[model samples]
Target: MRTSRTELLLGRTLLVVALVLTVLPLLSMLSAALQPADRNPTGLSWPSDPQWINFVTAFQVGHVWQLMGSSALIVLGVVPASLLFATLAGYALGGLRVRGGRAVLVFLVLGLTIPFEALIIPLYYQAQAMGTLNTQWAIVFPLIGLFMPFSVFWMRAHFVNVPVELSEAARVDGASIWQEFRRIQLPLATPALSALAILLFLWTWNQFLLPVVLVANPLDRTVAGALTFFQGQYYSSIPLLNAGALIIITPAIVVFLIFQRQFIKALLQGAVKG
Candidate 1:
């Protein structure tokens, strides 16, 4: 039953290669970001006189703080609401096994097959019709709807694996379904919920197209979405552009690092799922 040493060695080698591939680009970016503003960074070579102040300049020019605030507002609107509704839907379909749940799940799963690119045109017109175009709410509302299928599927994956006996026991004890979900299954779903929150946060944060299309004012868009405008505005300065990009992505990296344990725990928990 033990893993062979040769298999272990090959696995470790693959992981090392993957890590190197990931880190190299980030190192290249950092090296480029440290070079003097208005100077062409030829490649990934470290600058002899690194200009760390370029970050400060990029921040001011890019309005990094304001972009961050705008992105934060959109994320706050989307993730929590998505989580709540998806969890409820997942519970009903996966745990409660309510009538017609499979039909509902099938309908939701169909959403997973439809590309966001395909939906953008209709969504733009819908936003315009609803008079939410050029506002963050335009992006916010669509993202929540767009995120629902995957979010429900993710939560359902966790819930479907819950022991049915627990639900039966709760019912026999005269526990209402609400009480059972809130006090029992919900507590046990922490890992799934934590992982889902992180994923939704990352996706919503890096979401570029929706914000770009839905919100006309670049400053009103998410940071990632506004990078196009940022690039145009900072066209003369490669270093400053890289610095601005790094500044924008750093928060996502930090959040992932901080909660990586929960993320991994959820993965491990789901590994044996049906």
Candidate 2:
């Protein structure tokens, strides 16, 4: 009983520490954003006037709405494409029988080993050649491709946990393969799908490097890319930059918060079942 109490205390302490670690930077950024322009470059300090207008300025002058729109386009396109392709491919690789199944699975796994940085140059030239460069599709296509290997691997693991009897029963009932997958397997795979959707949304939203190389104009840049415009070679508008950063990060935070319970439940379901 004494040892259990001590363990509980330790766990609480650890949780508090983790919370502090996670929140410190966020608090600092907010503090900085609120600080007056005159107070910015003198290191960190409490806000004197607490200018709330910086957010508005960031949104308007900083081209935040355009960035948000671009980011949204990428996320909307990439998320569905990634999930559909990943789930279908994963289902095939995990549950269905096909010639070269193992070989195809191996090839997909090999994709996970190759880092994105290595392919950026080739991808850039290819996008340019294909006339997709500077377009939202350039960023969307590459992100979908980059995220697929991991999504497939994860969804495959989830699909493996589903009982084969379900598919077999559907088959016996004269259901076609498409009907079986669409009606039975896809419904059962919702938790994994939700989890994957949240993850893919976040990944695509936060993407900077790909957008940097693929897009040259601010009109086509993502929120992540737009944050870079706040800095100069010598000086940066720290307050405005922090405000922009906050604006950029807010959607993702709200997304996770709104779906947090679902996200956790899905994670638990995937872990236990898979």
Candidate 3:
């Protein structure tokens, strides 16, 4: 009983520490953003007079709405398509047991080790030859392809853990592989799919490097990518910069909040499934 109590106390203490560590920087940024835009604020000190209007001004000047739209467009394009392909590949490898699937899975896992940064140069030339540079496609295609390796691995993990009896039963009922995945395995894999969707959404929305490198037009780039251009123009206005940064992250926060229940469900489902 004493050991259990001690472990519980330690865990709770760690959780509190983590909560503070996560929240403290956000609070400091908020404090800094509330100060006058003209003066450079130091540390976490609150201003005598708060300039809440800084956010409003920053939104207009930073083109937050347009940035949001651009990001939304990219996310919609990337997430659904990536999920579909990853799901198909994962099912083939994990559920169907395709010929040479193990070797292919090894290569896909290896792809994960090859950092995105290394491929940027080759991708740049490829996009140029394809005439996609300076366009949203430049950002969209690379993100989808780059994301595949991990996404496939993730889905494969879920499908592998699924009971083989489920597929065997479906096969006995004269169901094709397609029907088995569509009707039986797919429904059971909801938690995995939902969790993967949220992750892809976040990664696609927060994508900065690919957009910056591939899309020359700032307006065509994601909000996070556009932040660099925004920073260049408003480097002197610290408050505006902080406000704009907060504005940029708001959509992601909203997304997480809206889907938080599904996210948690996925985690719990995984625990039980495993």
Candidate 4:
């Protein structure tokens, strides 16, 4: 089947429009960030004298290094723990026989439907009870649990498409269940795990509400949450604020750029599995 010329033209036009819509704001923000800090930069127009020092000012004023460290800590805690648990659960559910696995899966799928907003109150109080409030663990622990449903779903989607023959062949070679999972499946799961890691990192990095509500100290907040605080503190400094905002989101952008191929492959690999 071939697309008609009119359809092709229309599709190209739509894509161009989408690209502009996406890129225009980023360009506008970059322009704002480059403007002189003292001179309030208005709109997307390039400044007369581009002040690259706005980033330096924002970095210092925003305490961006500290924010980066805090966000990194959360990402390290959440991604590894969540991935380990989700991989194990996903493997058992998707690739192995478990008693009442269907019921368990249904429960996890139900968890996906429950919004975080609904759970925040209880989590806050629970953290307070545990004496972890105002600490990084407040964010770290909840995020891991909060991420479980989708992470498990993602891993299971990958694992379910894995052929049973691989497991059977491994079993015939005197491989135990743990041996098959560790030796055979995990090696084959690299792309999917990479994709999951990227997503987990992004989510854990960008988490705002949980940290804001649970942690009182600004130093303990994730970059995204700290950006909000920084916005309030520097509301008068438009260029600096924009610069800080850009800096806050840079890690996620870089991660996506580096792993984009593997990420796309993981998502699409199961689309037409043999």
* TM-score, one value per model: 0.95, 0.90, 0.94, 0.93
- Candidate 1's C-alpha runs over 4 A off are 231-233, 272-274
lDDT (Cα, tens digit) per residue for candidate 3, span 50-71: 9999999888887778888999
Which residue pairs of candidate 1 clash? none
Off by over 4 Å in 4: 1-14, 229-233
Candidate 2 wrongly placed segments (more than 4 Å): 1-9, 41-45, 232-235, 270-274
Error of 3 at 40 (Å): 1.3
Taking the tens digit of each residue's C-alpha lDDT, what string does model 2 give over 43-88?
5566767889878877776677888888898888999999999989
User: How would you order the candidates by TM-score, starting with the best?
Assistant: 1, 3, 4, 2
Candidate 3: the clashing residue pairs are none
lDDT of 1 by residue, 172-271 (tens): 9999999999999999899999999999999999999888778878888888854575566587788888888888899999999999999999889956
lDDT of 2: 0.84
TM-score of candidate 1 against the unseen true structure:
0.95
In terms of TM-score, which candidate is strongest?
A: 1
Looking at candidate 4, the ten consecutive residues that score lowest on lDDT are 225-234
Clashes of 1: 0
